[model samples]
Every structure is written in structure tokens, then in C-alpha cells.
Target: MPREYRMMTEAPPPLEITDLTTTFVSRNRRTEVVRGVSFTVRRGETMMLLGESGSGKSVTARSIMRLYGPSAEIGGSVKLLGRELLDLAEPQLRAIRGAQIALVPQDPTGALDPLRRIGSQLTEVLAAHGVERVRGAARRRAEELLALVGIPDPKRVADSYPHELSGGMRQRAVIAIAVSCDPQVLIADEPTTALDVTVQAQILELIAELQQRLGMAVLMVTHDVGVAAEFGGRVGVMYAGKLVEEGPARQVLSSPRHPYTAGLLDSLPTPGIARGALRSIVGSPPSVGAFPLGCAFAARCPHARRSCGEADPPLVAVGADRVAACPVVNTEAAVA
Candidate 1:
């Protein structure tokens, strides 16, 4: 089992988001990339945000960190360890950013600098938080971080530039930097997306191991249900900037109540299904900021009813620790 599956208690959770929305304003339009997405990650737990491309999963994660700068209009409650983050000033937020919360971005190559050695980058992070002063202490700490993330030759890797390392190694280095300060929460935005299948599994295992050792809450964003299933904790499914279904990973994946979730599961290739005959959800997701008044997935949902187009549905309880946004789920449950 993934390390994040371990049961634990942390009051107020490590991170809590409520009605989080992000909008980008332009001359002619205001695009709401994230719409009232809410979820929580307890200490040592992973909350996987699963969705397709353009579903606004990545935007939601960045919004938590307030990475959009002045171009985005963000509103909602983002609490870290019981303290609100949205209203904090930039200097105050900077203090909390790397020390309490960290981000493991998707492309390690792009994240790392080509000119500077890896050790310098890692030390920079330490210096930013005043974790270690003096060059010697910072270098030693950076080396230790590299070793902690499973770098074979920590000293050697640290001395090399970003382009000197392989894809997996660079990713490991990124993880090391993210954990250097021992943050309370780690937001991994597709940390394994660039690696091969085998490397992807290794990276996931590495993240789980680090989460256990550091005892940090993790918000992992990914499009792959298999990755979420392997991580095995809470699952939140998003579509058209809205959270459509959320519950325990096993329950949601096995007995998904929402039609969109069902479609995602059906799209995965199964043992019985022939190679070319695998099922796929018809129609693409609605464009950003252009979702219909009804359920965003109504156009592609096979079970969509007349009421689906009447108005957007709110997440309603369907089972133990589970909720789905489709009215049909409740109707089906009542009939059953």
C-alpha cells in the first residue's frame, strides 16, 4: 500500500480548501479556471485530484500556492495548519511557502537551471528559508537531501549540472529540493508525467516513502486513475473546473456513482477488452469558462437525464464518506 494510506489524525488537517475559485480577467472575458473546488488533506494522507487535460486540475493546485501572480483573481479559503493563506501578504506568504508548503513540478528539466550545478539549486532553497547558513552547511545539507531522495552518488550528482543527470535523477533532485525544508504539505503536480512507465512507478513509490518519512500531507494531481488507485487514499474527480465526485479511492474507483467517473473507468483498457475495441467516453470536455448551465459532463454522459440540463448540481452524499454531483446517483440509490 502507498505510505499515504496510513490512518492518522491532524486537527484542521494539513491543508483545507473551500469554495476555491480562480479567474483570469482579460479585455473581453473573465475565465473562471477553477470553480468552487473543495477538499482536504490530513497529515500523512494523499488526496489525488484526478481529471482529464483542461479539466483545471493543475490550475487548482497553482491557485493554492497563489502562483498566478497579478493576472489571476483568486477567491476562497485556503487554510494551512489552521491559518488562512489567501489574505496573507506576499512577504508573509513567502515565509510559509517553502518552509510549510512545497511544490514538485511536472518537468524537472525545465524546473532546474542548465548553467548552475544541482547542489547550488538545492542550497538556494535552503538559504531562501534560512534553514542553513554558510556555504559549507548548505552544501552538506544539500548533499544529505540528494541522498535522502535516493541519488546513488549524492556528492557527484550535486556537483553536476541539471543537464548532466537523467530524467529520473533530475526528478529525484526536484523531490529532494521540495523536501529540503521538511514542509508540512507537498503539492506534486504530475511529478511522474514525464518519466517512463517504470520510472513513473518508482517516482510514485519515492513520493509515498517521503510522505511517510516526513509525515506530510500530499495533494497529487494526475489524469491517470491507475496512479490514483495505486496511491490509494482519497480521490477527487474534476471536470470543467468543478469537483464532480470525491470519496475513498477504492470506493470511488470500484463503485463510481458519477457518470463521468464511470466513463473514465470504462476508458481504461481491461483484460477482457480487445486491444482495438476498448471503450472511450464520447465528446470532449467543455472549453474553459464555457461550461453549460447544467452539469458540465451532461453532453457526454450516457445516463444524463432532463434534470441534468435544468441547472448545475451540487455534490450530494451517495455513500459513506462519498459524494457525487449527479442527481441520478441519488435517484438510483433510492430505487435500489
Candidate 2:
């Protein structure tokens, strides 16, 4: 049967974050990394959080899973399945992490245990999450999971250790483990970052196939606009811990309202451009916790004016299903 034709019932979305903030503290000094980042991922829908490094995209994902350790301070609400997760007890959060919300990390080599075989690792996850009671049941379930993620030979792949498998295979194994317990939400944080271009495309296709099969909301984070465009979903452009622009992926790519977003799109490599003539965003990204009080992108934004430095622009509706945080662009749109 065709993947698109796969039947999936409507499942309630699990994630609804609001004013979520994550701060790291050391020696009494605090660095606010993710400041009031808000977004939603509905069932069977993908939400790509697009940004450059240090733009608080990864931190926001970690905060959603409560991965920040004892040193960090988290504020605001992270409601999963209509329940507030910000203040949940450790055990409660533990129950939710793998069983309800699964994460496919960037580096599969780092994510997988070198000392353990892939089969054992996945079996352990299944047993730990209470998906399977007996060892035999867990092992069988692990093999089924490996095959579910499109591994050619599930048994052989499962028997091998992380080092024995190729990079793409390792990623597939990681994903298989993530979905073993059938999570409602899958948080894929740059899952294809380390793979070659061909493998990246394959892995992304596998993810899409699995998302449709399982009917789980996917929150994918990436630095590439091309990836976001290809992924084909709603996109949230993050800069300096805030969503600068957000809308349908095609709309955002075709007509970017925010200068920062336009800069990112302009920076994509195009075949029409001459060799060595690739456009690049000017200036460096602001350091964490040191961003200016107003618009964080003002220093680097070409269209920035005096008022851009004076006050931060709120994310306002620019069109149907679109919003951007840019007074300059907004005013230009209003006039034109």
C-alpha cells in the first residue's frame, strides 16, 4: 500500500508550550537561553524550528523534555496532553520521557551506547518503558521496531553494536528505539546533521513515513532553510531566543516578512548564482544572554532603523496563517 494512503485516526496533540523560558546559572550569574518560546505541534503535523546555532532551538527542545540538569532554572508552562509539565515530579517526568515523548538526537553515535549491542539497547528501552514484560517479548519487539524503521535485515542489524553499523543505520536504530513504545510526540533535534546528503534525504523520508504510520506530532529542529522547505510544514524562525517569523513553509520561503528570515533565505545556495558569489548574512549572531534589549537581530539586520533599537517588535499577523516580529517590514507591508 502507498504510504500516503495509510489510515491513521485523529489523535489529540500532546504539546502546547507557552512563555517557556530556560535559564542556565553558574556562580550566581544567569544566562537565559530560551526566552518565552512558544509553538504547537498538532497530531500528524510537523513543526520545524529553523534557526542558526545558539539561537535557543536545541535548548527549547531540551527544556520541553526537562533535560536541563540541576543547574538550570526552567519557567513557564509545558503542557503535554493538556497537563502542565513544568512542575511535574521527577518520576512523573520520567514516565513521560520515553513512553509518551521520544527524542531522536542529532548524533546517533553519541546517542547509542558503544558497549551494548543495538538489540540489547532497544530491548532495554522497551522493558524500561514497560512496553514488554518479559525479556523474550522485549527482544522480539525490538526486532519488530528495527524492521518498522526500514532496516533491511532487522535481526542482523539488531545483533550488531553501534560501531558495527553505518551512520544511517545507526540513526534508524535510534529512531526505532524512540518509537518502540509508540510515543505521542517525537522530538527530532537535527537528526540528520551528521549523515551525508543522500543518507540525510533517506533518513528524512523514513521519518516522514513513520510519522504518517504512527500519527505522532514531530518537532524537527534544523539550521537549514532547504531542509525546512523540503520537510513541508509550518515553520518557526527563531533568533536570539524568540520566534522572529512563522507560517506555512512555502509562504515563509516564498515571501519572508522579517529581515532576519529574508537574510536566511537569501543565504541559501542557488544554482543560478555565480561561483563564489553565494550571499551570506552579515555580522555574527549575538552571544547568549548578551543580546540587546530591543530586537536581537537589529545589529545584523540590513533594514533595521532607530526604532528597531528602541523597542522590540511583537510577532503580529502579516497574512493568513503568517506572523513576523518586525516593525520595519510590517510598516512597509502596510504601506504597500
Candidate 3:
């Protein structure tokens, strides 16, 4: 296993989230999108929040960054290198947003300003964060950043507008902006959603390489199991706003302790599995604020019991460095 794949035992992780929750308050109703999700990302390690759409993985990532507006109520703790972020004032957060912490948003085209040149955008971030002050110096550093992210012709790409670059190049430019100040933590939410397979692989590889070199912790939110496997660090399986299971990527994916995790793996297309023979989970995930009283996944779980529907299951120890919120699986494991 690569060093990045192993859990770092550092005293203070680069990022630590505890019992995080996000609730959207509208005129008539409140929707809790993220419910008590928690995890830690050690330096130089990638912690993947893997789940299907509407599973709240992306919401959880945003909660860590405190990205929601006043209508969204965020709770619990988000600590970057032991500093609490939830209570930080807007100015304080503004100082940290792109310097100590950065985000590679899902849509790179939307992330970059269309009217501005890519080089100008990069220089803007550099100047805003005080990384470079002089106009010429900032422009040169922006070009260096473009080159750092593997753009072959940094000068040309920097000079081009957002619409002028290819999708892959745009995504690379977004990453360059994100890492311009050498943040301690990088949050990549669905970084490969709209990219081609080849570009997706390249982006993932570039992020991994950058993580290894910069010693930065990565929080990667994606619905693709392949991305989780490729990153190969820690994996947290989320469903209906809660973490259903979490463990080392290889262990959880290979020997899933939660039925939802198993269902996701089974749905993948492998060489041994025939064409059009995927085994999908029975029901769709529940919408926010409409979750059942008990286990959110009980309705679709194969091993659900009468008690499973009575209350929300708490995450329990399933093995070394692993936890799952499923009593049936825990009971079976204990018996075995």
C-alpha cells in the first residue's frame, strides 16, 4: 500500500469533524441535509466521502467549509488543525477560505469567472491571499501555478478565457486556484462529475500526486465507488445524511459491514458479471427531512430486523479502525 493509503497517527489531524449537521430553514419547513456526520483527515491522506446523489456527502463537505447562507443552520464542530470554523466570523473565514483551506468545486467552468482571463483569475487569488503583491510577480506566480498543475503551455492557458480551454484544462485551472496558497486541507466535491473517463483519471492522479508532495489532507466527495477505490485512503459510506459505515478503503469496499455499502459494490459492473446484470439496491434513498424514524436503510436492507425499525442505529465498532451503523451486521459479526 502507498503511504497515502495508510492512516496517519498524527496527534492533531489536519481536519476533524464531529457530529456535524446542516439544516435548511425555509418559510414553512426545515430540511436537515446533513445529520451528525463525522470524520478526520490526517496530513497527506485522502478521506473519501462516498455515496449516491442526495446522500448528503457534498452537503457535509460544504458544512465543513461553512458555505451555506443564513437560511441554512449548521451545527457541531469543524476544526482545521484544531481551530473551530463554525463560529468563526465572516472576515476570519474569508481569510482562511482560500489560504489555509480551499475547495475545488464540482463545476470548474462555473468556478472560474468567464469574463476574466484564467491567468488573471489565478493572480487575483494570489493577490487576495497576499501570496504575491507585485502585479508582475503575481502574474509570473500565476503562470507557475498553471505549470505546477501539469498544464503544458502555462503562458497560453493563463492568457485564455474560461470558455477557451477544454473541460479537462478548466478543471486543472480550478485545482491550480485551489492550491495556490498551499492550504492545509483540500476539499474536492465531485471533482470528476462531468469530465471524460481519461480526464477524470488524470485529475485524480494529479490530486493524489499533489497531496503526496504538498503534505495536505484531502476530503474527496464523490458518488463513484471507482473514485473511492482509486484514491484508496479512508472511505466513509454515507446515506440519508448519516455515515452508514467507515473504514480503510480496501477493507470497507471488500468486506462491507453495512448493507448499503454492499449494495453499492454489487451494483458495479465487473468482468465476471454479465452485461446488464447489475444488482442495484431495492429502493431509492429517502429525501432530506423525510427519513424514516429508525434506520434510514432498513426498508431496503436484506437483513433488517424488527428492532432495526425502532430507532436510529448508532455506529458501533466492527473491526480495527472501522465502524458501521447496522445492528444486524454487528450481531452477525459478533456471532462469527
- Among the numbered candidates, top lDDT falls to 3
| lDDT tens digits, residue span 1-336, model 2 | 665555444333588888889999899699999888878788888999999999999999989999977778999888887778888899899988999999999999999999999999998888887889698878888899999999999999988999999999999999998999899899999998978999999999999999999988999999988889999989999999989998999999899999989999888778899888878889999999988878999999888899888888888899998989998988888999
1 or 2, greater by TM-score:
1
Lowest summed lDDT over 10 consecutive residues: which window, candidate 2? 4-13
Q: Give one digit per residue, the lDDT tens place, for model 1 in 271-301.
A: 8888899889999999999889889898998
Better of 2 and 3 by lDDT: 3
lDDT of each: 0.93, 0.90, 0.93
Model 3 stretches astray by more than 4 angstroms: 1-11
TM-score of each: 0.96, 0.95, 0.96
lDDT computed for candidate 2 = 0.90
Q: How large an RMSD does model 1 have?
A: 4.2
Clashing pairs for predicted structure model 3, backbone only: none
